[model samples]
Target: MSDKRPLLDTSDIESEKDGIMGAKESSLLMTGITYKSTTVAPTVVWYGRQLLVRRKLFVGLLVVFIFSYFLIGPADVLDLDNVDSIVQVHHQSNVLDREVNQKLLLPKGYLVYSNQCRIVDLDPYKREVMRHFKRVSYKPCKQRLPLTQMRYDDHTRRYVLSINSTAFQSYHVKNVLSCCYMGVERVSESNVSYTHCEHFKSKAQISNTTDSVIVKCSTEKGQIYINGHATIPERLQIRQRLKQWKRRDQGRRVPSVLMIGIDSISRVNLIRAMPKTAQYLYDNDWFELAGYNKIDDNTFPNIMALMVGYNLSNAMKYCNPYVSGGLDKCDFVWKLYKKHGYVTSYGEDAVKINTFNYLKKGFKQPPVDYYLRPYLSAAEKLLDGNVVLGLPHCLGFETESEHVYNYALEFARRYRNDSFFGFFWTNTHSHGDISQTSSMDDYLKDYLQRLLAQGTLEHSIVVFFSDHGLRFGPTRSTWSGHLEERLPFLFIWLPPFLRAERPEFVKALRENRNRLTTPYDLHMTLKHILTLSGRTGKLETLDGAKDCPQCQSLLLPVPLNRSCEDVAIEDHWCTCWSYKAINKNSKTMRHLGERVVHYLNDYVTSFRNGSLAHLCQPLTLQGISAAYKARLSDDDPSQTQIYWLTFSTAPNQALYEATVRYNKSSTSEDNVQVTGSVSRLNSYSGEADCMNDFAIKKYCYCHHKSG
Candidate 1:
């Protein structure tokens, strides 16, 4: 025992360093033998080397996969850069059925017809029939188009030209329905007061004088029930009211030029509202010297057409408003007085904020010295006595109408002596706060009467119109407004200076000038008034009118006969767009861009009809509100797209489903969050049973109790 204790010397030092378990194991092994133990070191392994050997396959595969995604994947598709070139297969064409005519939504009076003529089917005459002159509708077809059909029509003949202007017997497709007269009343010797005409049995008065003229018109398309459900005429009735209107205007002097700028306006309503405005504009004493015709009923395109002497779908786009030369850019009127070099102005609040933006691309700032820019500078350039085509904003609510009126009056008073070219007034006074601007119509009548008394509209050709109709409906709400808001009133006053060409010109204009006109025809109308003949949209610019391209307006609408033999299917193989074609041959993803543009063009229509239905569909909003709230709260914007789909309420079958896989920055487990959205092109209720399907099968067989 004494020897063992003595041997427990410095050995304990190394013993302590090693674990007690290791020392015991060593002692146990050395127990029976003569132990000659010594401390020794063992070799260790590097983690990097071992790791490389153990996961060599995984590392190699990951690198190859990443390289494949960025490099090889692109090569496999059409070789291209950006979204347009990526080889994406759209298996379904955007072809549609039961398509509605766009003209149906256009402002009232506008119409669309086929450009081709065919033989009357039911008629035994088998004579050349131009059903093309009627409004667009499904009709039976039996035309074996002759070789002459290959030829393009003249540009000036672009209007729904009839093989026979009054082919009443060839009423192959009768769209003409009832016609209406606008509400009008002479408020003064020179001015007029107007309102919408609710009934056909109303007396009206108008005059041509040095003061302002006003007109108002209104109409609605609704089922006319006899007792309760028995409806009157199903289609619109085209009364022979044009003849009466001609008689009213025949004795008057139409303004040399009339400027109509409907704030947030469309074309159809303009047609219904035109009679009152027209009667006032052409009253005997005004510029009545007019030789003008109307083009189409659309406003923006019509105006542009009137300005540029080309169709809305003109091949050489861009109506460079500032340009002085070239027949292509300038309408006949502008071409006539390019040297007059008058400025254009938009002092009236009528110019929509987005108007200029839509006119030019990336116009975060105004386009410098642009052709339309002159419309903004017209009031300033009176010294040189230049021709001016000017429009000023008619802002309200913030600014008093009287103040704006007086301000404009001051400007006109100063510039009356100049040989002015053109003018457009916003007419803010016509707008209503029927609740606030003066509850009583008498108040507005009197206020307007006072303005007339001031006699400021003494000299110039004047025309008045509202871009919209009253917001009032059957029921009254403060927030109540018209669906496609329009203020339908236009008045015009013209001076004696342009009076030289009155006799013959006034007669033609008195008979036909007020027909359906596009805003594009405004320039054409002005030119004709200036005694310069040109054709454009048939309006003032008849001298500058041009043709639309063949492919655009031509639609192969489904037929009424419903015979498979009646339907013609042509080769669509040439329509197959190859990846190379998109990448190299096409213009800026030509095919893809066109589809996108079409989708955009048609998307708004869904909102006007389908989306509204979905939104107001008592069940949809109640069912999906939770989902929408959840979706909108998301920090990511992409999540909202799905929410939109839900709000759109697209049916399961209607929705076009797509799944995109992307690598994320997380080094954790793979997870996916399901989302939803509806089509912008078409509206439908989008629903699902299993949202988080591991497989992106967009189909659903179950429905949750709505919300």
Candidate 2:
């Protein structure tokens, strides 16, 4: 029931790397530059025409320029502040690709940017400069602190954890030594090194507890464990806790469930975590898919995709946000049980992943625009049960990890009833700051070991998994590659009654123990676990939930509101109020497509309101005529011979932001805007080569040429 994995001695390994597993998985670990958001300065240099011959070359150029400025100027006057004024801010595709890069630039919330800045997007496909400013200030979050990397390979014997502090005040924050495995024994330590934890530097006793075998520390918040050898329970204590509840014997049907999460679980990792969880549940179970993916290829869209049953696809344009479930149309599943009389609670960090709508239960454009209410799914805006919840994760740099986990543990301890469901979630301490799975696994194993010992994991079906796997780092190896999609885990611990009915599933498990499975079947799986399998019926066990070879539907749900609405609807269906758009035949944006245009108006106002447009009118008199305002084709324009004739500028100089307004034929008078910015790369002496040095690939150069 426990592992005897050997301790990873770091004496011979360099301090540079804490612990690197075999080279195969080690590819994802590394330490790199710290990021910060700062200010950008405008760099506009004017070159006066030197020769007299240049003057006589154009006639009445002033009049023509005057008119052009006025025409394009009006579009500039419209901005985000006014975008909502004339336009309905409904979503196109709920997918949020452009997560604000707050680390690189300070945030001013929704509608703002730098003054000298040319509105520019961080697009890299064109082989041309994409950044907007030449002199932007950067302020790091904290002073550069010493970073420590350590790895532990522990199993049912000695519990171990690595301890390193950052300069941040939180890094100084350590756990209280309240508990440890009684059977735990620290063997030996040859290489013990410390350089002052960068974050917790002010503390007197830097190393709270260190012996030749291990190290320990005590801070105000909670207990911290480090690298050692240890043993964990074969079954969790959740079942043991459930026994204390009077409702267990009072219940005629399955009433309570737990959703455990295994961060970044994948097809590969599932093989590792699931069977173990399943065996635990095999004895006694009550839980579901802690994490799931609707489509297997896109990791960022996994969370959002799980509710509905589809991928958000390329619609996530700007930057991928963590656990972005808004990337697609989906609804919360708890609604079903809430209607059937069940209480639900979340004991995880604030779900900041849906920054645009975290508090909104991170609502997506479910087949129906509906929110999950505390009340049963049957009633609108009603409470199904008294609930205990925590702040949703805005999901970024703030270190609230321990808080999120402890919150879940606390809630579970408080409300272990027969009619409730609770989820404990996490995303950080995974990617962003720390970048090692083995390192992550190293800590998680020890934590589980302790929690299991506390009798926190038992009888209850423990569900664990992650939104998706992490991309090691920005790499040449990641060109639309699917590495980010394939590896996530879906470990489940189910009780006997649960698996007895799902024979096919049991067969799948008993067969190879090694095969590919994704969250593609999650919606059905979760519903099955929640006992709200709709037409699929409650599964008796993992053996019953398996896809029967003859089963055609596999119990997958159709669109939510597919009943009487006659208006044409596609893919998933919904009967919620949002689906009224379907009834009224209202325009619906696809994967943030409408969202893209809705914001264009903001950029437009900035342009039209600024004096730049009014003064540049002569160039276009009325801007590019509506007739010539053509849509940008997918082909890379710079590579086209036509691009050389259409616009003329040396390479790139002062970041130029031009805004144009157009409406798609489908929606007349509704304006869409496109904003462009060219990076000011180098010193502009006289003239520079406009064509970049590298083409097609990302590391290319493009600048102005003046001879």
TM for every model, in the order presented, reads: 0.31, 0.35
lDDT of 2 by residue, 430-530 (tens): 43311222223433445555545544453344556666543322221121111222334455544454456554543333221112223435544565655
Write down the TM-score for model 2. Answer: 0.35
- State the C-alpha lDDT per candidate: 0.26, 0.29
Q: Per-residue lDDT of 382-406 in model 1, one digit per residue for the tens?
A: 1112111122211111122322333
- TM-score (C-alpha) between model 1 and the true structure: 0.31
* Candidate 1: Cα lDDT at 19: 34
Show model 1 residue runs off by greater than 4 Å.
1-260, 264-300, 319-338, 341-344, 350-354, 358-407, 425-458, 466-501, 513-516, 532-543, 546-707
